[model samples]
Target: MTAEKTDTLIVGGGQAGIAMSEHLTDMGIPHLVLERNRIAERWRSERWDSLVANGPAWHDRFPGLEFDDVAPETFPPKERMAQYFEDYAKMIKAPVRTNVEVKSVQRCAGRPGFIAKTSQGEIEAQRVVAATGPFQVPAFPNIVPEESSITQIHSSNYKNPDQLAEGAVLVVGGGASGSQIAEELMRAGRKVYLSIGEHYRPPRSYRDRDYVWWLGVLGKWDEIKTQAKKKHVAFAVSGYDGGKTIDFRNMGHQGVTVLGITQSYKDGVLSFANDLAENIKEGDIAYLDVLREADAYVERNGIDLPPEPEAWDIQPDPSCVTDPILELDLKEAQVGTIIWATGFKFDFSWLDVDAFDDKGMPFHKRGISAETGVYFLGLPELTNRASSFIYGSWYDAKYIATHIGVQRNYVAYQKEK
Candidate 1:
């Protein structure tokens, strides 16, 4: 069968793909967007029942669009966010084809363009953008013993506390998802054990400004990934509970047993590292540093903001440091569930191109891949710290679209010559 043709073919109909389609449309570029499922499928299906966007509504949307009737300072629920994206796509009139799974994207034989094989059929395109984003695979650690009796579920499949077997829960990972899930389980009157890891602890709000706002004003959001000095895999913040600081210490006080980094499960017992105190101290330092930076920024810019609250400077006592539960027998603790809040991994195996690094990530300089005419969008640190955030989509899409336009124009000039 003859393949359908287009100037550009965008893979994945999530926020990233839709953003790319919108920009390409604005530039009068003829393109097609292919989605395996409905648009914003992950936001609708993969997220937990109580999940809300990590960023506030004001800072989480594309340019010139505000979340419908939602407070700027408040975070939108997962359902609301999914609807917002669907509405945004409709408003832009993006040429998106849902339920069309792209099988592979490869360079055409003796040709400059690419041929994309999809479930529906085949398509030839001058350019391609892999906007599949990062949350492709649920990353569960190898440490968990498969022979163990306890039931396990990754954060991606986790829906609600009622779905789990009746017993204590061991939530592995100190990231945002894990921390939130652990807290939710504890509040549900379940004995919860949270394994802490190297994660950032930033206040949800400082001086009446959201944490994301500070990151933007401080210019931290625009910092390139490679040049970044320190990076934390996850931030501890809860948007579901009206944007609250996720303090493991407070969680401990609320009856959740917070442990150190998970080591391994041996003979039905789980082992943990002895760095609970150190983790707390590190998080404390980061918390103070952010507040201090905010203070300095206010003074330097001569901006009127609220003074730092006295509670902000207070550090909790590291009670979990001295007598940390380094080991626990799954049966003895009545732990019936092991929830892996270990985050997600990216999969680019569908793209048969010589543009990946050792980790299978595309070698791209801010979405422009080493393989010409192949671009990546919505990956972590693709351009800046904000590259994966909802607000970052607009800027990254613009950059990718501009490159496509320039390349197309240059090719046309070469043909004329």
Candidate 2:
């Protein structure tokens, strides 16, 4: 209700924010964590109805927090993850105020702090940390027109197969969201048109254990220490056809029509690039590359793991090449729904600061912003490939929080001297 002053201002109450809050609290610093909606708002609303946490619960927990009383191996659904965040916030007594949206975060012109204008009121703080996370704005490509007549759904708004039209669905993008949605639609007995690009079909499990288990043991995630390798990380396996594997190795046999990347849509005709076959080939290459890395890790560490199962053949189906859709008439194809699983973009327009780059991207080394009192967390490739991931976010938060606390306390101590 009133303008409150704090030592630090946290702009989100998600995992990163709460993690940092715990650190700041232990450091005996006054801070406030603000969320526009409920904590874990994206997990609560933006996700599809049937969507589950892409990773297992055991590996997803943050520092000082674990999924207690819950099955560690279970892949939790959207609501469950949301509740986990809510419960975690309560468990730690994080100073989170939900429904308070930050409108702008501006540096105090001649001062050593920031002023955050919010829907609730203006708050002043010596340090401001943005933990808003990635996946904020839905990215729709220019290829898709805005005035199209048929129904279009961004992957964020999608819930389940029942929400789609009674006609065929054309899913654009072949990454995790696209592949998962296409498989879901197909399982519901709907004709699915999948637009393919470079994708990886990493097996969910390898050699009697979850693939992530091997990653943990081999320190794969930690090996990704630079931004150069972050872009190459493959998406999670969609347990569609194979209950435990990706099964994209047999995409052509999955009863879904594969197409090239959507290039343009005009006059009821959608044009696609002639790169469908090439993309599929690239996917095979990615799969092999990833498999080799895993195998090499196991061998180098003298990990005498059991050999890959005899029944689990990762060999690509010979029928990968079928009729690729170069272009299609919307009316003739009878496709009525267009789903855009094109990924996300970030909008930091509200953070009125010159520390941002020409493209409005915040300039930060790790999580510390270019401006001394400002910081950013929960960004992809911030420090490592996992910087944006829940498991990796806490590390960034901890470092940033520690820096802010030492700097704030030192500044205060200087005044006393």
Candidate 3:
């Protein structure tokens, strides 16, 4: 079949892809965006029912559009967030083709461009941008026994309390998703046991302003993703209930059995690491670090923000640290559900290009890859700390689109000469 052609081909019609299309359109660059499913399919279907945007709507939107009917400080539900993207696509008139999956992207033999094999048909382009953001596949540890009777589901598949079997729940991974899900289950009257892991504890709001705002003002959002900072996986905070800090210490008082890291499972008994106290201390250190940073920023700038609250006021007694559940028997504890909120991983195996590192992650200077005509977007820290967020899409998209336009213009000039 004769492959369809465009000046540029963008993969994955999510916020990143659409943002790229918007910039390309503005620069008079003829491009096509291909989505495997509907626009923002992950937000529409992949997310849990009660999930909301991690960032507030005002800060997490495309600069060209604001979320209607959503308060500035409040996080919009997944449905509203998806609709906002759909509306933005229409508003910008992006040439987006839905239900088209790009199976592979490779250089055309004896040619100067790329040929993309999609579910619909082939498409050739001078440049290709892999905008498929992270969170493609749900991941879980291989600790669960294959023959266990307990119902197991990843956090991505969890909907609500009624979806799980009636009993206590063992929620693995104490990242943002795990903490939030564990809290929700506890509130729903389920005996919740949250397995703690290495995670940061940034407050949702501090001193009358959101932590996101503080990060922006303090110039932390633009900081590049460094190797040392990568270990700080996620912040234990929630946006659902008016955006509050997710302290496992406080959660324990409210019925969540905060335990240490899930180590192994055998014969229906799960063993936990005896580092619960250390984990709590680590989280406290992180939490204190953020507060100290905010305080310094306030003092240095002379900003008239509210005074910092006493640490004891916000921090609850870390009772679980001294008395932790080191082991749990599934049958004895009546724990019938194991929710894996470990995290998600990305896949870039389809690209037949030498643009990746030893870890299979695409290595690029900003969004431009070493391989000519290849670019990437929406991956965390692709350029800066904000590169993975909704707001990050604007600048990354503009930079990539502008780069493509400049290269295309130079080629045209050479041909004319």
Candidate 4:
């Protein structure tokens, strides 16, 4: 079959892909955006029923688009966020082809281009931009109990309280997702057990302003570099209930059992690390580091911001912690659900080129891939710290589109059917 050709081909029709397509359109460069399922499929299905953005709606936007005169300061629900992308696609007439799942991508053997094998057919292009998104696949520990009859589900699959069994839940990892899901379970009157780890505790509101506002004013996200993005990005404090800095404090008062990180599991017995106190200290240290940076910024800029109220109100409480290092038998403990909020891992195995670095993730100098005529979008700190977020992706998309538009050597690859 004759492959349809375009100047640029963008894979995945989420925020990143949409941003890329919009910028390319502005440059008068014909392009196509291919999505595996529907546009923003992850937000539509992968997220929980009551999920909300960590930041305010005002900052979540692509180029040539901003949140309308509605709920700018408030957080948007998952469904509304998904609708915004779909609506934006229609507003800008983005060339998005839904349900075009890409099987593999390879460089043309004899030309300077790529051939993307999709569910429909192959599509050839002079330049290929991968907007495959930040969250690709869920990552879980290899030591989880496989023989046990207990229900095991990743946070991505979790919808609401009714989806799980009527018993205690063992939530692993204490990052943003883990914390949020654990709280949701608790609100539903389920016994919740949350693992403690080195979590960043930036306040959602500081000095009568939202953390997102301060972050933008101080350029907090921009300080992170590309190298650090590949290593381990620090977890943000959950922004579920507005922008509160939630720790393990007072959780016990609310019927929460806080434990140390999960170490190993066997025969329905889960062993936890004896480092809960140390983990709490680690989180505190990270929190203080961020405050120091914020203070320095205020001093440097001579901004007369008022003192942060109740910033240090959350203190380490010994009562909130149970046995830090205990082995709990799932059946005996009445725990029927194990939710792993351990984050995600990207899969770039189908790319038949040297697009990955030492970590098996796509490596590029900004969005330009190692292979010529190939690009990567929607990655954290691809160029700046904001590159991974909704607003930040637009900058990366613009940069990639501008560079590709000026490249005169992008020759289309084609063969006679």
Better of 1 and 2 by TM-score: 1
lDDT string, candidate 2, 1-417, tens digits: 566799899988887888788778888889999999999999989988877776778776776667776677677777888888888888878999999999998888787788899998899888888888988899878775778778888999999999887888999888778888888898899988888666666667666666667667666666644534436333646533333555454655877887888898889899988887777667666556666767787788887778774433445543434556677888788888999988888888778876787778889898888878889999987877678878789888788878987797678775435
Ranking of all predicted structures according to lDDT, beginning with the best and ending with the worst: 1, 3, 4, 2
Per-model TM-score versus the true fold? 0.97, 0.92, 0.95, 0.92
Error of 4 at 32 (Å): 0.2
Q: Residues 1-417, candidate 4, lDDT per residue (tens digit)?
A: 899888789998999999998888888998999998999999999988888877778776665667674477788888888888999999889999998888888888887678989899998888888899789999888767566788999889999999898899999878778888888899989998887666666666666667777778766777643444224634757658765676676665677788887888887788888877776777777667667767787789898889874675656565646445467888888999999888888887667777888888787899898888889999877987678889889888999988987784334345669
Candidate 4 regions with alpha-carbon error over 4 angstroms: 224-230, 299-304, 320-323, 409-417
In Å, residue 96's CA in model 2 sits off its true spot by 0.3
C-alpha RMSD by candidate, in order: 1.6, 2.5, 1.9, 3.7
Could you tell me the lDDT of residue 210 within candidate 2? 69
lDDT for model 2, on a 0 to 1 scale?
A: 0.78
Best by lDDT: 1
- Candidate 3 local lDDT, 301-401, one digit each (tens): 89898886764255555566667888889899999999999888878878898888888878899889988999999988888888888989779999999
Instruction: Give me candidate 2's TM-score against the actual structure.
Output: 0.92
In candidate 3, which residue ranges exceed 4 Å CA deviation?
Answer: 224-227, 230-232, 311-318, 415-417
